[model samples]
Target: MDDLNLGKKLQMYRTSRSMSIRELSDATGITASMLSQIEHEQVNPSINSLNNIAKALGVPLYCFFQEEIIKEPVVRHDSRKTIGRPENAEEVYYELLTPDTNGTIEFCMMVIPPHSNSFDSVHCHTGEEVAYFLGDGDHIGITIEGRTLHLKRDDSVRIAPFSNHVWHNDTDQTARVIFAITPPSF
Candidate 1:
């Protein structure tokens, strides 16, 4: 996300509500300077900070991310209609907004087109997981609790379910990585 661009969106929302930085600060208990930084996109906000602002602005926290999606009454982004995509293209399929589930955690879908590489070369997180999936030969490779649980299409496995686990599909076909991340890995 463009940090600088965020300021404009924040400013728009604030002004539309006829709320100044000081007013927002009083309402949200946030410093006006911090609010100004956020409005200018100079600072990336923490979850608590975002929630405070969302409350003050009378919007959902997810409104800041899915600008276009929030405009629709229903979630309309479809995966099947994604054009020019290969048989197993690596693409983010969906973004789930669950306020009841602490809202900080996010779940996104990734389709790894056959014989393709991950957009995240390698990454790390902080929790655990109970993992399972299926695909083609050597299709699923997940690092779970220090063990590399590998599975092929239709094969299933269980993991401890932690954020430290990593998933990779190094095959000629696409594999889906179903995830549950804490503290929201958006």
Candidate 2:
């Protein structure tokens, strides 16, 4: 399972959520030294412990194993739905697929300009999100997810939250996307 890489992933997600070791300690009741050790691969976290960290981070415990995550690019346009155009650097946009504010899942489209940031607010609630990005050469990172998900054209990712998540563009071009979430968040 590549303990070192998994530890790094866990650390990344934890820090991305703006969570400090002490804060995580408070939330998950783990120690700062232990969390630090886990990050450095000095100690292996048990599955139950990993699950606790995952729960505290608001992410699935299994996301640490996703490999072969490819990158994609953009070229054309189609109406899958949620065609929202948030002003930013990526020149990109997206559509939401569900009622995140009404039920359990909030769906929306995201259009990001290159080097743009995707977000509405540091909103919080129950459930999680899975974003299928359609922007090629667009760099998208959800802080709550820890690592950045770079897409080529059809890359997708799922995110849970331990803190407020922000989507950022790393490329200096336009990007587009579709975001879906469980549990309503308006």
Candidate 3:
């Protein structure tokens, strides 16, 4: 079952890059016919062949075994995957709004309950992040590098990479925010 799925994914990635089977075959040193068979799920490729293909496609070998491929660009609200809350923070929730692909940017929706914080401590990551407030009521509190900024509705803020940051919702209403991170450090 996994072999067939891998073949389909390979085909999708190759076609998405506008690369022909012959081109991939020449780049990977595999025969064109074998490449076609592998793409069609008619035959399974060895580990070495898969590694070569992955190199030619400019993707990691593990990409074939990751989550299901996104058939469309839009992510439905109910179908979004949750990244799970912090161990010490139950008042916050996170949902991944973008598909996990070979992209540098990742979108996530975060909900912070009233009068609560997202995490117990500030966290830092390698990639930059920008967060925008969604609702028209209340201001979301964001602390970055010891500076606190209160963001109003539709307001956005950028945070540098490696800066310690956390979010808080001090109002009586829930705070909703959509954040985009580059290089997907989360």
Question: Which lDDT tens digits does candidate 3 get at residues 1-186?
Answer: 242277898999999999999999889899999998988877766545675787799876546645655566878877665543334243576667886544678788887778877776787767889989996457888999999999988999999988999888888887889999887754
Give per-model TM-scores. 0.42, 0.42, 0.60
Ranking of all candidate structures by their lDDT, best first: 3, 2, 1
Q: Give the Cα lDDT of each candidate.
A: 0.54, 0.59, 0.75
Candidate 1 C-alpha lDDT tens digits along 86-142: 332344232342322234455444455555434333344433323346353456776
Instruction: Report backbone clashes per prediction.
Output: 20, 42, 0
Q: What range of 10 consecutive residues in model 3 has the weakest lDDT sum?
A: 82-91
Task: Encode model 2's per-residue lDDT on 78-152: one tens digit a residue.
Answer: 523222223322334444343112333456666666666654333333567777777655456655535444555
